[model samples]
Target chain A: MIEQSINKEPIIATDNNGIVIDIRGLYKSFGAHNDVLKGVNITVNKGENLVVLGKSGSGKSVTIKCVVGLVAADKGEIKVFGTDITELDDKQLNAIRIRIGFLFQNAALYDSMTVRQNLAFPLKRHSKSLSPKQEEDAIKEALDNVGLAEAIDKMPAELSGGMRKRIGLARTLILKPEIILYDEPTTGLDTITSREISELILAIQKKNKTSSIIITHDMACAKLTADRIVILKDGIIEAEGSYEELEKSDNDWVRSFFI
Target chain B: MVISLKNIFNDAGNVTQFTARFFKEVLKPPYEIKEFIRQCYVIGYRSLPLVGITGFIMGLVLTLQSRPTLAEFGAESWLPGMVALSLIREIAPVITALICAGKISSGIGAELGSMKVTEQIDAMEVSAIDPYKYLVITRILATTLMVPLLVVFADGVGVLGGYAGININSDVNLLNYFSKVLESLDFIDIIPATIKTFFFGFFIGMIGCYKGYTAASGTESVGKAANSAVVAASLTIFVIDMLAVQLTDIFF
Candidate 1:
């Protein structure tokens, strides 16, 4: 394991290679009541599952988006693998981005492509020397991991809601990304499907040994997949603990999420 | 609401800036040759049937409609020369562009707008893919190159229709009718018309792409983008054509 440091004096501690992501005082806003993210801070250790819990508009999604440099912050630092992503140029950002996978709230599958072709996009793009056989194997492996190998030939338009989400996960996983950012992965799913998806997230963590930051309002999803849950409120992390610890908290509002 | 001059100028500035950015990005590395070819096939070759049928009808109808007037003056022999010159010089290119402005522009706009709202474009970006090079540049270039080719196709079919129209009521042979049509058109009539079609294609594609690529998020916004694209592209076609004619008049 790589050595890391936690600076006790400052709010954020980023001088650590072991920390896959270290965000310091991150801030963003879109004319909401307050800044979307005001002086936010977070850290994801190597091979860890960090769940960001918040209400519908509490900027949980925006927080993870900043980690991938998808949503630009008004102020603060976002370091992915010890590299400050906010300062990187387009080419440099793309270089760092390949290592990070983001699953949107709606899946965001390409309407024009089949599942096979959709998975093939990132595979064909980043790795120029991949053979047809190797690509096929990777596609199959990714789909199998997500347990949707049968949906390979189907178009996104033809897939059910859960199936679309699984295919979307397959597309992201095919790249074998080191860090996955899942935004509301189980929002629209049924109770059973949501639990299944949650298990898939856990399976991915153990099998692939990838770090993840999952943002969700689904407490069930948080309980299943989280190693540590951070409650985001008023653009900052209000509470951070294990599921059992945060659930029994004294703060009525923070405890409100549990009930 | 009343139209403000400031809004008009700002709109022009934004479009101009968008067009300039497109030129810069289109020339950059990582050229999407395969996708560009695919777009060319979809935007150009696919549009031929519509333009062809429209061209033929326009020529045949013009010939039939103008016959009575020519008969009154006893100058019916001038029909072939008049229609040929008009079609080649202006009618075919403008009409074909208008057709494409309705079809291709709306398609590009709606496709991109939907992508925007659904976050497919955002997905491409997060996946480390160059969505601008892959989607915007290819579609715009396809439009820029395809519309001119479609106009040429329209011109040929329109003149042929004129020849057939003359044959329908009279004993004019196909060979003689074609020869007379050819005799009336020179490089001057063809060159400026063809040159302007390139501009038509460029603006139609550029406007459509700009509208869609910059579309605000919503399903309703997608339809609006498509409708706006048609209106904007068609209006620009006439603007470009008017400038083309004035310049041609000064030069030729």
Candidate 2:
């Protein structure tokens, strides 16, 4: 609900709260004809919760995909933690990826692996110093953090929608990423569960001091979770501000959601 | 005609992107070495029985069918060498590759395609896990290692089946038949044919993983990826085999 004047200029970079991600003039298209993302620019500060609100197929997902190098951009520079991700080779990108965590929309838990194994996966990959006992203790701590300590032995299929989300969060936290991305975290959950997840997301950001970019169509989620919201439409930024600033905008599309 | 041409061009473009992404991600580190071995077990070791049985039956049936033809030439003893050469140089590797294309390729395609449809892959990306290195490299490595082993086993069993046929139906001595078969076979025929299987495995693994990994939106796309994996892998195996034969003939 904090009001701040909107400006197109890049925010001044300071070392106190370092700029974690800087995306400049990003462009992506599936082919010669179908463009999914036009030139887009954004920056995320350390420990900030930035929500991306857009209609389905508005390139919100595509934008984040480019950030992680999941979907390569046709042009532009993406800098993460002062390193230019666009110029990074695969090895450098992977090194950056290990420091970032992502919570998939559908939880994306490996069906073949149990919750314990799922949590162990990233830890095993990213952590070399942890002994088997320490890995087990860490898994227990992560699962407990998400309040799913009891579901450690269970498969993803056995869990409810909300529980699966918790497991996904646990898997993401296992890596202790400096940045976390959430893609429609609450889209399919009921009202109560959705709010619970939002609170859980806030708790993680506070405790871990991790920056986040959440892509969702749920304005309620954007309002409750984001310090700043960026609304995308037709592959371009339509509006960018704090929740209260967007609510007060004269733009019909921005006002429609509020009214 | 124009519409069809346009469609082909569009498909080609998509394939190129998929290929580019695959190559880009594969060379990256944090390589899924353990997952790669597990997948090799699934795609290669688990698939061995089926490939072996099929090769055995193929050798048996082919030997039986060729007996009468060779009998007419009064050269029935040549049956052992002919069957042995064909099974080692052609049938075992091609058939094993095809079976793998059907089984491993389709399975990978369907599994990944469904993951895409359900947004699981997106979740991994958000979590900062490189799903490509985690998923594609493991599978491609599995196919690359396992296919050659499958081909080797299939070729050995197939020759035994041919020996079984000659021993049962004719007066050909089991020892003499095997000796003739072994004498006719050299490392050159076996090595080159087996070598081609690595490429076959690579193609099947790459095409299958590519189709599934880049599957379009929705549940139907999952089905399309699975189907396309099989079709693309089968076509690639045949094309590679033809090219290999032409090269081998010219060189040797």
Candidate 3:
């Protein structure tokens, strides 16, 4: 376990190893009794797909939310891009947030807006200098990347679950974020759609060269997309390895997940 | 019982803080002018028919009910001025504001509550957009500007309804009826009532946005937020009206 930095200075990795996200001794609690995350540590390297596997209420979602500053950690050091993000204010945090994309389980599309408007929302807010035609082209290109170019003008309510997830990905990718955190990218989809979304995750990592931490119960998605996997048990990481290595583990609890 | 009381205090503090943040963000740059206009169209223009109908009914009913009392006093001729004064100085503002609390506040609460439940608000936050500025401030500003205008519309429509009601018993020409109504109203009557409606608008928007923005994580909380927004906003309108009335009485 890495020690919490007392000075909150940016940690320079000696080897210049591509560790984009380094979390140390993260703690979070809800109310009095619910100690959701305890001394959790995680790191995501450049261009890596790290899948987080945990049972319900194990704080998998909270872990990524902490990374993005959506959920405040009780105590920890979250170093993203060598800077300790836990110490950053809202303005500073938003700067870091702009480089990271978070995909919610439900896709989180603005229902009041059409797909075209939804895609344009973040773009118009963040990139004010882009011309109208450039903004339109970006929206079109993003939708095209998700293979949903034809669904541009449709409202979010008009889309299927799989299509919504894809459009969610399109919106996430619109700003060309370096890292994407996906929370159960295939939770509610069927077998075929789940595979499609998983494949898209893989395709996005390849195409965009983006590092991602995907939280999921879908082992198939894990096997297809994860370069490494971490399993959470009792609020801390219990095991960490590649898919096949953990699949054959002697620990009955970890191996049970495979069966 | 103790916990529920504590919860009430907690909610009051939260709502106050939320309103403070609203004032802070509303003055900042990158103003959402476009969304503000859209919200005005939704909260103001869309609300006209219901407000108009309620105002007309309120005026007609007040006039009809008060007729017997005026007749008994042999002051039937004082009907137009009495109805006009009541409608302008108290009834129109309070009733119109209450209707808006029911309609606009609850609508905002439900819309924003749904957005919260679905994580669309979080999506906006992660996109480096301030959800409070974009969603809360815009809606609050729209309501603040629009509710006063609605009250004014209601006052006018109600006076016309009084004209209709007055013609039922005796022949009063439109010009003469309006002349009497106009003679009854003064700057004191109109200004204070209008000022109070602005407060009514602010509280309605503030309470609704507060409830929705701070809703707990669940599908059920959306319904809870919407329900509570109406109750809270309605209560607040009465409280503000009472205070406004007292202030008006003391000063004027």
Which one is best on lDDT? 3
Pitting candidate 2 against candidate 3, the one with the higher TM-score is 3
- Candidate 3: give the clashing pairs: none
Which segments of candidate 3 are over 4 A away from where they belong? A1-16
Whichever of 1 and 2 has more DockQ, that candidate is 1
**DockQ per candidate, 2 decimals:** 0.83, 0.42, 0.89
Residue B168, candidate 3: alpha-carbon lDDT = 86
Chain B TM-score (each prediction, in order): 0.96, 0.93, 0.98
lDDT of 3 by residue, B1-252 (tens): 999999989977887789889878888988999999999999999999999999999899999999999999999989999999999999999999999999999999999999999999999998888999999999999999999999999999999999899888889999989888888778988999899999999999998998899888899999999999999999999999899999999998
Per-residue CA lDDT of candidate 1, range A1-259, in tens?
0001111112122337689999999989886656788888999999999999987778888888787777888899988877888888887788777878889888999999999999988777777667688888888988999899999999999998899999999998877778999989998899999999999999999998999999988899999999999999888889999999999999898999999
**Candidate 2 CAPRI category:** acceptable
Which 10 successive residues of model 1 chain A have the least lDDT summed?
A: A1-10
Model 2 regions more than 4 Å off: A1-46, A69-96, A228-230, A233-253, B1-31, B116-134, B166-177
Model 2 Cα lDDT, one tens digit per residue, B9-102: 9978977886677677776676777888899889987998899899898789889999999999998878989999999899889998999999
The candidate that wins on TM-score is: 3
